[model samples]
Target: MKKYLVVLVSMLGSLSMMGQTNTWVNDPAHSRLGFVVKHLTISEISGRFADFSVKVTTSKPDYLDAQIEVTAKIASMDTGVEMRDNHLRSADFFDAEKYPTLTFKSTSVEKTGKDKGKLHGNLTFHGITKPVVVDVVYFGTVTNPMNNATTAGFQIKGVVKRSDFDLGPKFPEAVISNDVQIIADVEFSPNK
Candidate 1:
């Protein structure tokens, strides 16, 4: 009976570990990684990375202790103008050839309300990493009719200084604003 009790305890431990977290894949079709920056200290230039991936791990329905990671391809930036987009990918800016991807990993999630929270994370870009805090809004969840998978939506907004990442020096602050505004609309579906 002692041996059987030990076996049962091991099984229960395994089950608890397996159920500790749920994995969710970002749905690219319904997600966007976008940013806006001021140009010539006047008009604003907006762009987005066409390719990005995100994974959300959570143990609770409220997402109070959730963790998130994201990767974005620098070569996929689109600013509508071909020349400007190419310039952004060159050594003058992001240098997509050397640093192919920008990444973010969350450290903490603080829930403020039923659908609002503050997400603190480390954002890595242009070979530098810095802590950033962003406002997050949860849009609840739904079951997809096509695949019968549970999906959740979220919107995140934050601002980061380009100079903090050592990304740009070719243009002065007057020519190009140092601040970059980030906005992301993300949809995640549970992994099968």
Candidate 2:
């Protein structure tokens, strides 16, 4: 009788904990997913995917155990130059018409400091998926004055090789650098 009661209590406790997990959705108006890569080994060019969504679920306030998922529309990519952007969407680059989207789903997050961590995830782009580790900085949470809602801010930075995913194969390192730097500034609010 005592063993049965204990088991029931344990199960209930687990359920309660699960219920505490919060789902946060990105505030698109305050977020940017951008990247930079060298152009001609001299100058650098920057671009951004204007359409993306990020959702994070966690029970901890610091988000140490957060599970994050991201999806960005490849067709929304903008490089400030119409011709270059069109080129990037073609088969020589992302082939946006065929792939349509890039995604990431986090596998683990390791705390490194008071407000920093390493996020490990699988990034799918250009029809290829690869493991990636990005540095994360939590800028803490604040109550929005206009909406009276709590918002959290974070910055994620990483570098990925275009060659690894067979992106822009015709472009050499001297013309277009292989290393692409990704930087995202995002804000999230608890889903209502």
All candidates' TM-scores? 0.88, 0.90
User: lDDT for model 1, on a 0 to 1 scale?
Assistant: 0.92
Q: Name the best candidate (by lDDT).
A: 2
The residue ranges of model 1 lying beyond 4 angstroms of the native Cα positions read 1-19
The list of candidate 2 runs beyond 4 A from truth reads 1-19
lDDT of 1 by residue, 21-81 (tens): 8888899999999999999887999999999999988877788778899999999999999
* Tens-digit lDDT string for candidate 2 (108-188): 999999999999999999999999999999998999998999999999999999998999999899999999999999999
RMSD of 2: 5.6
